[model samples]
Target: MQTNEIDVRVREILRLALKTDVPEEGSYAREDDPNWDSLKHVEMIFMLEDEFDVQFAEDDFAKMGSVAAIVALVEANHAA
Candidate 1:
């Protein structure tokens, strides 16, 4: 899938998992969003994995600091 396609799905998954509408600019992060707490972050990861059908490494969990990061991760995994 294209990065834009993955971005759309990732945003939807984030919307469901994070329970809020993510910004269109894709600059939001856990440190900046009050709704992006630890539990929601985990839920968002799981949702991303399920939506993209890829399991993330434990180290990758900490790297998901922003929507763009998640899109990049999924795009990389999808390419492989």
Candidate 2:
């Protein structure tokens, strides 16, 4: 898939998982959004895994705190 396609899907997943619309041009982090609590974070992980058809390592879970990070991880996994 193309980068823009991955970005759009990631943003949609974040919006649905957090139940909030994400900005198109800004960094979003769990620390800055109340909607991105532990439960929601886990949910988002599952959603992303399913959406991207990639399994995440337990340690890699920690790296998914931000939209940029999540997109990067997903892209990396997809490439792998």
Q: Name the best candidate (by lDDT).
A: 2
Q: What's model 2's lDDT at 31? A: 84
lDDT of 2 at 21: 78
- TM per candidate comes to 0.89, 0.91
Q: Tens-digit lDDT track for model 1 on 1-80?
A: 88888878888887898788787665777777788888999999988888889999899999998888998898878778
User: Lowest lDDT 10-mer window, candidate 1?
Assistant: 23-32
Query: What lDDT is obtained when candidate 2 is compared to the true structure?
Result: 0.89
How does residue 60 of candidate 2 score in lDDT? Answer: 96
Clashes of each: 0, 0
> Model 1, stretches more than 4 Å misplaced?
none
Report how far off residue 49 is in candidate 1 (Å). Answer: 0.6
lDDT on C-alpha atoms for all candidate structures: 0.85, 0.89
